[model samples]
Target: MTKSHDVSVQDFNDEDSNVSSNPTFESVLNARLSRRNILRGSIGSMATAVLGTSVLSACGGGNDEPAPGPVPQFTPIEKLSFAAVAKSLEDKVTVPVGYTASVIYALGDPLRAATADYKNDGTDADFENRAGDHHDGMEWFGLGADGKASLTSVDRGLLAMNHEATTDEKLSSFFLHADGGKSTLPRPAAEVDKEVNIHGISVVEVKKAADGKWSYTKDSAFNFRLTPWSDVELSGPLRGHALAKTKYSPTAVKTRGTINNCGTGKSPWGSFLTGEENWVGYFARGAADDAARGDKSVVALKRYSSVQGGASRHGWETAGTEDKYQRFNNSKTGASADGSDDYRNELNTFGYIVEIDAYDKTKAAKKRSALGRFAHESAVFGKAEAGKPLAVYMGDDSRGEYIYKFVSEAVWDAADASPASRIAAGDKYLDKGKLYVAKFNADGKGQWIELAMSNTAIAAYAAYKFADQADICVNTRLAADAVGATKMDRPEWCSVNPKNGEVYYALTNNSARRVDATGSQVTVDSANPRAYSDVHKAKSSPQLGNSHGHILRLKEDAAGAAATGFSWDVYLFGAEADASTSNINLSNLTGDQDFSSPDGLAFSPSTGICWIQTDDGAYTDVTNCMMLAGLPGAVGDGAKKTLSYTKADGSKLDVDTYVGKAPAADTLKRFLVGSIACEITGLAETPDGKALFVNIQHPGETTAMANIANPSKYTSQWPSNAGYGAGKRPRSATIVITKNDGGRIGS
Candidate 1:
C-alpha cells in the first residue's frame, strides 16, 4: 500500500512538508456572515436538526432556497439485523450468513461480441474491447431502450468504472522471464500495448434477470473501453494556454488519454468525472530538464515531485519511438520552436478531472482544466440551488496536501436538467469556475481561500510569480501553499450526505507529522491530532506517524455551496481495538466497528447510510481490509473528548476534539472482508438500494513478479474459490452483493 502509480510516490512510506498558516479565525468568520443575513436561530441546533444535508443545503434565506416549507429530517435506517461477519485471513470473499456475493465482472472480460473469451493464460490480446485491471471508483447510469436517462431503470443500465492501475506480472506473460528477470530492457510491443490499454475507464452495459441476478451484457452496443489510446479534448481556461502546446497538439486544445484514474464522481448533468490521480509517475523526465527550465521551474517541479531525471514504474519510455510510446517521455528531445517537435509538454496535459459522456460514444472526453490540477481523488458535488452557482468539492490525495472547492460561474437552470447531451451542459458550467483552497483554523471554523491570479496575496508571493489565471490553476499546490491553506493527511474520497447535505472526507494514514528535537517536523494541529507508533511488518523499527487515520465533517455557511466560511469537526478517529491507549480510540469503537486506513467512502443517496471501506497495511496482520455499513448521526451528536496515547519511549500525547457517538453493533457492522493483500474500494448501488456493487482490487498483490507464473505460490485465490475455478491467477474484480431473501441491502 506504500507504493502507487506515480513518481512522487507519496504513499504510506512517503512524506511531505511545507504547510502554511491560516488567516485570523474571527476575520474569516465575520467576512463569511457579512455576505448574508445573520441567522436568527441557534447555529448548532439548526445544524443538528438537518444533519444529513450538506452545509450548503440546510441553510435558509438565500435567493436559491426553495419556497417556504418544512425542511425534512433524514429518516435513518430503522434496524440492522444481519450479523457482522468475522475477520478472516482466508483467500476468499466472506459475507454475512444470509447474504450472497458473486463476481459480476473480472479483468479481461470481453465487452464486445466479436471478442473471444479471456483465456486466463496471459495470451489474449483484444484489450481494447476487454475489461481492465485494478477497478477503483464507479457509478451506475440508468439507461432505457430509447437510450435516454431514467433514474429507476434498474433492469437495464450502463456502468462507468475507472481502472486505476495495471498488474504488471499477472496481466502479461514473459515480462518476468525476459532479460533474466530484469525489466529494464526494452519491453515487447505486445506486452506494453496490453498494459497501456488496460489502465483507463470501462463503460459496460448490465442487465438484471427475473431472479434478480446481475450480469454484464457482452457485445452490447453501449459497451466500450476508453484506453490510453483514446482521443480526449481539452476545455476551459487553460485549453489554449502556451504551456499546454506540444507536438501532439500544436493548438493546445487536445490530448491523448486519461491515466491513473482513481476516485470518480458523476456530474449533475449526467456525465462521468474521472479524476487523474498519481499521473505524475507515468511520465519520465530528462536528466537535464531542471537546467533547461531554470531555478523557478525547478522549484515548482519539486513541489509536485516531478523529478528531472526520474523514470516511470512501467518503463513506458523504452517501449518505442512511436508518438504513442514517446509521449510518456517528458524530456526535451527535439530541437524546434516552442517545443512543437517533441512531447516535452505531454505531462502537463494530465492531472485533471476528465468528463466523459457515457451515453454518447460519438463525442470525445473533455479534460476540464478549470477545476485546478493536483493529485485529485474524488470530485463530489454539493447541493445545487435553482438559481445559485454549483459547487464541487475535491481533495488532493497526497501526504500533507490541501482540500479544494470549485464554484461555477454560470447559475443553475432547470431547463438544462435533461439536455440532449450532458457534455453540452458541462461546457456551460464546468468550463468556467473559480477554484479555492481550504484554510482550517483551531476554533473549528474554516475558510475557502480563492486561488485566483487577482488575489493580492497570491500575486505578491515571491516563490513563483503569478502570471495569470491559467498559471495559478496549473500550479495549484504552490498557490495553496502561498495562501496558507490547511495541510491535511492524504485527503481521499469525499461524499456529501444526500439527506442533509453534510460533507465527509477520508484522510488516509500519514507517516509524517511528528515533532523533532529542533521542531523541524510538522507539529500537531487541530485537524492532524494523532502522532504515534504502529507496528509495520516490513521494518523492525516502529512506524511513527498517524497510522490509523481519521474522518472529518464540514458545514458550509448559509449561502450554501459558494459560501466562503464553514464549520468543521472530527467525526471519527480510526484505531484498532488494542491500541496503545484508550484515548487514541476516540470514537470508543468496539470489535465490529474498528478499522484503519479508511480510504473509500460513500453515502447512499436514497438511504443516507454511509459506507466505509479500508485500504490498509497498518493492521492487516490482525485482519484483512474490510467494508462496514454505518448509520451516521449529526455532526455534534457526541460531546468533546480528549485522545491520549503513550509513545514507546514513555512520552504521552493528548488531543481535545468533538467526537461522534460511540457506535454499537446495530448501528455499525462489518459487511464484508476481502481476500489476502487486497483493497476493498469503489462502491455503488441502484436507485432501489436492492443491490450493492463493490470492487476487489489487486488480490495477491504480495506475489513477487518472479514467481507470477506459479498459481500455487499466489498469496490469494479469490473469486477462484468464490467461482472462477482452479489454476487461475488472482484477478481484481467487481462483486455484486444482495440479500438472499430479495430484501433491500443493509437493512
Candidate 2:
C-alpha cells in the first residue's frame, strides 16, 4: 500500500517499509567533474553471509532473440555519435541536436474505434478502451504484415505497457475526477470505477508511416487491456492455492485483475510478463481484521505493509458494497478457514508476475506465481542457450528486499521460440522453476540461496512456519529473510547486457538508508555502499541516506545463468556532478553523465547500449528526471577502492568494495531530459535500433489538487504544452525517439 506515515505516493512508490542501519567498512572513490569529457579516476564493503566463492568473467552473448521478434544483428558500438544533452528544468522534453521525439500514445488516448477522445479535463470516462495513466515498464512484440507475430518487422509491432498507478497525494486520485474527487472516506462509485480501470496494463498496435513518423492505431486488432476487473488465473505453484481462494472463485482457479503493474518482461516464447507492484495500497483492511486473522496471518499481512485501519489508497474500498467494491476491502469477514467464502485472501491474489500473450487474445492472462512475488520491478531473462535452463533475473523494488533468479526446469528449445501456443510454452518453462534469492558478499562474490520449504532455514524459520511450496511462494519475503539473503537498496529495473551476459540493476535511492540502524533502514553494505546527505534540496535541509542511488552489476558463474555463484561490482554510483570526489561522486560522474535514482535500466540488443532512466527527487532542483545512454564494460574492470564516511557520532567509518571501470565521454552521456515533475521510464527499442520508445510518466505531477481549477497554477501541461492533446493538464504518454538520419540510435 502507499506509505503509512503520511507520505505521498511520489516519494514512496509503494516501497512498503523503511530500513535504517549503516554498515561498517572502508572505501575510497574516484569522482569526476564533467559529464561529456571525463575519464574519471577508480573507486570502491561488507562481510555478508558465509557463501562459496565463485569466479566470473565477461562473455558477450551471441546475438540472441528469445521473443518472437526480428533478430537484428548487434555490433557493439565503441563510441557514441550524438553530443551529450544539457540538463534542464523546462516544461518540455529536451533531446540532442539530431533526434526527434514524437508522442504516439498518451493517457486516455482511445484504443477502441468507438471510444471518445480524452477531453483532458477531469470528466473523461471509459478508461477501459483508452490508454491508462502512468505508463511504466514496457515491451515490444513485432507484428508481421500478415497480422501475426513476426521476427522481421520493425516498423510494425505491439507495445504492451504497464499503467502502474494513478497520481494521487491527498486521499483521492484527483486527476481522474470532475471536481478533484472527494478527499474524505466513502468515494463515489463512478470515480472509483475510473480509478480502478486505469491501474493495469494496455497493449496497442503502433506502426510507422512512409513519412517515418510513428503513431498508434485507434482500433488495432491486437489492442486489449488486462484491467483490475478482467478474469485471470493464478498459475504455477500457486494454482488452486488455498490462500488464493476468494468469494469470486472458491476453487482458487481464477481472480479478478492485475493492479499496480510496474516492470515488464518479454517472454522468449512470445508473451508479455507484467509485475504487480504496490497493489497492497489499493485494498483496505479493517483495524480488527488483523485480530480476526490471528498472529500467523498478521505476520504475513504486516510484512507486506498493508494498513490495518481507516484509509486505503484513494479510498477505493468505500465506494459501495457490491462485490466489485467489497473485494477492495481485505478484511476477514467469512468463517471459511480456506478463505473460500470471502475476500480476505484477496490481497494474496496479487503481487505476482502475470503473463499474457499480446499476440493471442484467445488466451487469458495467468499470474505465474512460481516467480516469488514481492514489489517486483522488472524481470529480464539472461542470455538463453539452446540446451541450458533459462535464468530470469528480477529485483524486488522495495527497500532492503532481495534480488532473485528463477531457473526453469525445462531447457531452452529453439523451436519453442515461436511456439504454437505461447501460453502452453509459459506452462513448460515458467511454471516450474527453482527461485533463488541473491546474497552479495564483501569479497566481491555473491550466491543464490534457494527459497524452498526443503531449505533448512525456511523449514525451521523461527518467524513464520511456511507450510508448503505455495506458502513459500506466497510469503517469499519471509523465506528470503529466513535464509538471510542480502538486504539491498531499492532494487528497481534490471537488464542483462546483450553485449556481455552480465546483469545490471538499478538500486533506486532509499530514504530509509541511515548511518545508524533504526526501524527498517540499515547501514551501508558492500552492494549498497553509499550513505550521505543530498545537498540538492533547495527548500528543505539536505536529505540523508543513499540520496543518489547506484547501479550494481553481477556476472553469473562460468556455467552461465544456471550457476549458483557470481561475482559483482558497483557499475555506476548516481550523484550530482558537483558532489564530493572521494565519497558521493564515487563514479566521478560529469555534468553530461551525472544522474540520480536510477529506476529504469535496459540494454539495446541492436547497439549493445545501456539506457539508464531516473525517478529522482534528491536532485530534482537541479534537473528533472532524465535518461542517459551508456556503454558499460565488464563487472570488474576497475581497481578496488576504499570509501570513508562520517557517522552521526562524528567518527569516520571505512568500507571497501569493487567498482566498475570508469567511462569515457563516449561511454556514458545524457540522452534526454524530461518535462516538469516527470519520471523517465519504460524503455523499448526496435530490433534495428532506429526507433527508441520511452515512457514519460506523470509529467507535471506536482500540480496541486487544489489547483484543478487554475490551469496556470498547474505544475505541468505537457504533451499538451508540447502540442499533442486538448487540455493543459499533463498526461502520461509514450514518445518515440529517432535519429535525424534514420540511423541506429546511440550509434
* Winning model by TM-score: 2
lDDT of 2: 0.81
Task: Work out the TM-score per prediction.
Answer: 0.89, 0.92
The number of clashing residue pairs in each candidate reads 11, 35
Whole-model alpha-carbon lDDT for candidate 1: 0.74
Candidate 2: where are CA atoms >4 Å away?
Answer: 1-70, 646-652
lDDT of each: 0.74, 0.81
Clashes of 1: 11
Ten contiguous residues minimizing lDDT sum, candidate 1: 47-56
Number of the top-ranking candidate, with lDDT as the measure = 2
* Per-residue C-alpha lDDT of model 1 across residues 1-747, encoded as one tens digit per residue: 224322233232243534334322221211000011111121111110100111101111112212223322345575577777666676877777777777878887888768877766666788888888888898988765456666656566778989888654322322212221335557666678878888899998766665566777776777888988899998887798876888989889998989888888988888888998888777778889877765465666677777888667567777787888888888777777566778777877888999998877788899989998888888899987899999999988887788999999999987777787899999998999899999877667789999997888899988888788887887888898888887787898999988678889999877765532113245556677666666655557666667789888888989898999988887778887555434457677766677888888898775677888888877787678898888777676777665554433556645555666777778887788888888998988777677888999988777666665777877876666566522367778888787788777777
